[model samples]
Target chain A: MREARDAMTKYGRKAHAITALVREAEVHRDVYVDPEIFELEMEHLFPNSWVYVGHASQLSKPGDFITANIGRQPVLASRHTDGSIHVFYNRCPHKGVKIASEPCGNTGKFFRCPYHAWSFKTDGSLLAIPLKKGYEGTGFGDTQANGGLSKVKNVVIYRDFIFARLNDNGVSFEDYFGESLSTIDNMADRSPEGKLAVMATPIRYMHTCNWKMLVENQTDTCHPMVAHESSAGTAVKVWKREQGDSTETPMAVQLYGPFMSPYEFYEQSGIRIWPNGHGHTGVANSIHSNYSDVTGYLDQMVAAYGETRAHEILGEVRHNTVYFPNIMVKGAVQILRNFIPIAVDKTLVESWVYRLVGAPDKLYERALMYNRFINAPTSIVGHDDMEMYERAQEGLKSNGNQWVNLRRLYESNEEQDVTAVINGTSERQMRNQFHAWAKFMTMDMDKHAEAAE
Target chain B: MITEKTITDLIYREADLLDTMQWQAWLDLFHPEARYWMPLEWQQQDPVLQPSLMYEDLLLLKVRVERLTGERTFSQKPKSRCHHLLQAPQIVACDTAAGVFKARTSYIYTETRGDMLERYSGWASHDFVEVGDALKIKLKRVDLVNFDAPFGNIQLFM
Candidate 1:
């Protein structure tokens, strides 16, 4: 297998060759289609990057835990007795069986592996082993090296959103995200109490396409007007027919109509590209800006923060903020989408809606409505996007086009400070993502350390 | 007096309308204030408090049907089709004079588009009311057996 992988030049799968697949204006299609490249991503990209685990609200109580995957590794994030969040590998050191089998539950005082009675505390320290006498002469020990759950190297909980990285040598969270952390801050700040609680269950939708396609689509503002014409466009026609000569538009129309917004509107909204493949659309306004005012919601925001601060929070309207690789957060709408790669050709997307604490019920209801209308498995608007993704997955198999174009507005872009601003329809986000992809894919630990030294 | 047979017939007719892609007819069967709800969790109480798989009023349902029938809707270019295999509906509550009728049915619904076909087994509970001699759907709550499982695009009404 190593020889076959080492000899890979068909799609440029070698170390030096991987960077060649991504260029300034275009990317080789194999990056999205090749299983070997996907394996490399699981190895190099996902582990080295901070992946979202769960919201702190999920582990609000002691012993509360959620099981998630940081790339290919199954991990458990739990609230310890000390009130700190801890992430550990889900594997039981005894028989290598998964300690926590369910997605989420309380671990009580400690996690007792169902396979064996070997137990570990919420902090992942070895607590008690039932058959300790048998291992007295053996080499087994109670420490992490022998029996306890292995803790993940790095875990960061920024403003209640939890993230874990498998490797300690990778870039720190602050260095990796930088200004893009504001997207999370913005979402949390919408609450009068300055906190966001995730709804209990997420709407999980499986996509028959590569995970990158979903990430790219979040920032691909150009496609909505064209791809959603069937769903969002028809919504306009229906509203017109339903309210002939009437000036009033319904809430349903308000939700679905913006996907058919003209190109000029999106272009004027603008896009902000941050470093490390992170970016968001709607510098001035977005589809979320037009939502009708929720009763009493503004009053709560005003009471929480003074008028000026509240205005600053509400005024900063942004659309899908791609956190690079796996997650996208829409601060304007309180929606977070985590894209979990299942296979080379399959991805599972979990869409979570957060409730702005101390806000009116109507606001959270609207968020839920938006989740149903746009991200649910039964979403009419989401189906069109899914269709396009599936089509792209199937079409990329052809040898006719070796490269996928990301040339739109690549040449001329204005950069100031650590961020760049481009037209909303520009493909700069895609190019930025590919740049990060190549960097992560080709990174050498030895070289990185030498450079740091 | 609305008999059990009449209630079962109405339930069957609703399923048939969906299965045959008679969206307009299906829409007509709904009361003006009708709500279609598919709860996310088992025995989920409040659709407003918790997120639901689907919870839509008549207006939203109309928009979905409109989109389904639209020419430009590319997802429907290869229009999705469905078949409902329903068990005999049991008339849970029948109050003829007061104009309140309720029925429960077990259904296996299959939706297909292109080469992908998904099968879902669920229980459909219907709340009905008489609107000028016609029974109309006030609420249709569907509880899928695998409601918590990860799913693909469910393109049609179930």
Candidate 2:
């Protein structure tokens, strides 16, 4: 306990001095591996900032509710009868029993706690308790204005995505997202109906690492070649056996084959770092090229949004886009994953892929193919990632290293907006994340004092 | 008339094949057009709108098997071993047109990894089609007892 307190104090002191001039590169190793910093991050970083709850499609209609965690805080996101969305603390207001036990379901009309039968409307308004007569004598049986399920402050929904802020202060979802919102926009804009539906049951996984590691790994372009080497190498041999040559197989299959080619070609493909710490790395053009199954759907997109706009939307083939903090969007496969920190060492990831509404069934099938082959529990890619994450977590706990280096592209170049366009393999993304992290953790608490002065 | 002993023996042999990691022989047990599925548990009211864990056809199943046995498959480096125990096998129906025998069997399956052991109880509905002299699997639908519960990596063919 004493050691923990000392570490906390040390972090608290250093965090206070963090500024834009703190060399946007080179984060203290403690940030990634330390338990003390992880605890502080849960309190200061996750709770205070806008964290993704789930996609709006997950709860499309009235009584539709899905249980999701926002950094260890279990939340129930429901769509009310009036078509408004509510994110509420899952715990019952009375005796603190969890309101819903299932991962997701339609409550029909209201949420009823199994423990005491205390019910709340879909909007989380207090409806009635079975033993209300006993509570009438006290000040307990109040209406929505007084007693109800605790609502998450400031909920924002944009383009079928839901984000919530526990603290009302800080920034609006627009300001918080900045240019990162384009990833969401581009995804939705591709659909002819201007919407996408959650295509399949989400594949959930638990990784024994800080949630940040998984989030960072999404944009860490360098690891794919090394980490997925075995999978890719095998893919090449299989393709050779089946198709007899690489040219005969489809690009999707070819991309998965031959690990060496991707790493070598990645430099030519280049990466683009956006204004708000969101980075896009990998082959941009191949995302929508020669997807035979989606050709008709692409035509519809061209018709709905116009050919020029459609081209622009389809042209942005960013493999991974880090929406800073909790959300990581994979544009190529239309997979969105959110990392919810379970503990200092464990992270719960909910992976959801979408089907472009009004698109052909074959297109949806293609998406499912990618989901099953690349992201599913049985996936070779997912297994490799999980192994690395678990290993990294175990390695970081050792006394062998005090700091993890982020000095790869530290001195090459700098961006005015605190985002640098470093080599895709550089640790710039991790450094950029910590830069944003320190800002949120040590936010000016003395604003009122300064105002009073 | 298929006796209980014959059905039980067949099921036990199938489990043995899987447990012993005889993947190719297991694959051969299925008919060319076999449909294997593990559907997601949807709300009792609306089934079509929601997605399932698996709604695979033969092609997809072939791809899955190919990938699993593929040399580069990293997830299967240390293969998974499962012990399937069938408690009750009830004959559901016999279709002459399809030349298929249908049966539903309740099972308890346990998988061990090092010291970690996880158990799952489920009922499987098997459809077997007799082609010439051999019996081939037409379909194997497994409905887990706790279908909605969060599961660990389901790496193996369940």
Candidate 3:
């Protein structure tokens, strides 16, 4: 371990660790099982990156707030009187007590700290202090930083998808995300009004596994055929039995049965890996290719966007897009999921369904069905993935195999870069992620050291 | 007067069938067109418009049964054992002319699988209709106290 530490440089130390663990085709089990590494991830990757906070639509009006977390820090997001969004630490500046207790609520005008009676504006600017002149000349309220509820270093709202970074030393969210930001735009553009909003409260479930497992599973096409064999296969069998010799199945069956698509189909789906560790697979022509059309919806879209533009908008379908560290989006169904790592082995997955504003009732209904049928805690498909994730976490703690293989389909004919298109079945996405993980962990060490110095 | 005692007896009888895993007997309690619903929201009023944890017609119910009892249902491989403890039911409403009756009851549904046990306690309301000779369930709604809370995999009916 000391010898590995001796190879340390501001940038090159990560390279040594990267080479030792993540390779072109395989990764070591220590990444998942080690407590020290998890701490490093929380410190480096989560707060430092452009982490997703919540959507602007969720904080509808001034004073509407939603409390969320970035890494281990409790963060609060709200809309101020100026109609701008603010993401700040949820703690009171006085004694560091939590300001809001609920998941979401409207703070109306200002937030009054329940503990010390200190008040702050919706944007977290300190409003008024209780007992005004207690410390007349003691540098009280002398500096803005010392007075206000501290703002997160950066908050970016790209077409309603809100993101914040605890560390200010990163690129713009657009520059950081690159082409992957289009998934958000495409989701919003699907509606006739060219906007999207979250409908209903999100359905959250817990996975007894490390958080990374859930993130990687988003674009993993290999497991659906096997892991989801029971639920997907059951849907197909039951639909067939009910239909006898008929060629058509119910929409529910159609939605689920596609998980059992032939390996050849997935191979043809194609995968897109962004240089920034973001990736997604082709999905416009999926099992939902022939999903029943909602009456009057297309015409409404055409009326709003014209024929050509509407058809182009309607034609685009990208399945699940992993927005790097946080957020997984299923474009067709409008289900977005992100995981909160509660502990070393526990993760809470929050799944939010979206409503394309001005879209027909049927469209939102489909999203609701997709969310209820798959993302809900009672979902059979989610159970299968959860079971595998928990089992993997358990197995990694064993002495049987020190290496978890990502070697499948890694022998590439495709050109490799930070951003590259590959076969859907290839493990390139997972490899791409670890490549970023190594970089984030190693690079942030220099920052932490500088902070210490 | 059909009597509250009879209603309580019927509710307990239905529960007994569920605890004992008598799927067929439980099915027999419901009318052919009955709906069994568990709304995702706390006081969800409309299943069609709102999301629901479960909204099953007879066909869907049969499919759930098939999956739970079938040979290859991976999650239910070892099967789930449930014990239902019901308090005496109270009649909420009765319309003899329309042959419709509604009763409210509370129960604790304990499900054991492998080495884990989960208890779901909730108020339930059964809307019944007099079908020919006996009572048949028109609607069965489980207002789970934890409906607003997240849950693990729920393999058995509440």
Question: Per-residue lDDT of A1-453 in model 3, one digit per residue for the tens?
Answer: 833553453223344554477766678887777765676678777876788888889999899999888877899999999998988888987778999878888999999899878889997888888677875687875865455888986888988988898887765677779988877877888888988887677877877778888888887888887877777777777677777677756667767878889878778887889866788876435545667778898899899989998888778777788887867987777888988877778788888888989888888878887787788777778877877887799899888778878876776653434677778787888888877676666654554544343
- Expressed as tens digits, the lDDT of each residue in B25-94 for candidate 2 is 8778888778766655633222223444554555455555566665655555665668888876787766
**Candidate 3 local Cα displacement, residue B87, angstroms:** 1.9
Better of 1 and 2 by DockQ: 1
Of the candidates shown, which would achieve the greatest TM-score relative to the real structure?
A: 1
Looking at model 1, residue A401 earns an lDDT score of: 89
Model 3 misplacement above 4 A: A1-15, A142-145, A243-248, A412-417, A447-453, B1-6
Give TM-scores of the second chain, every candidate. 0.96, 0.80, 0.94
For residues A223-342, what per-residue lDDT tens digits would candidate 1 score against the true structure?
A: 988899877887787778777677767777888889888989999899998887888988879988988888888888898898999999999889889998789998888999999998
Q: lDDT of all predictions, in order shown?
A: 0.86, 0.69, 0.79
Minimum summed lDDT over a 10-residue window in model 1 chain A is located at A444-453
* Interface Cα RMSD in Å, per prediction: 1.1, 3.8, 1.8
Please identify which of the two predictions, 1 or 2, would achieve the higher TM-score against the true structure: 1
lDDT tens digits by residue: candidate 2, A1-453: 844553447454244433422355555556667676777777677776788887788888899998877777888999999999999989998788988877778999998989888899998888887866876667654544346899997999888788888876876777777777777787777678878888456766666677878877876667777777656555655556665443556644644553345654555555666544566665444323445445487788888989898888878776677886788886656778777787778877767778877867665555555655556555666777877877677787777755566676566555434544445566666666766776777673444442343
* Candidate with the greatest DockQ versus the true structure: 1
Candidate 3 TM-score restricted to chain A: 0.92
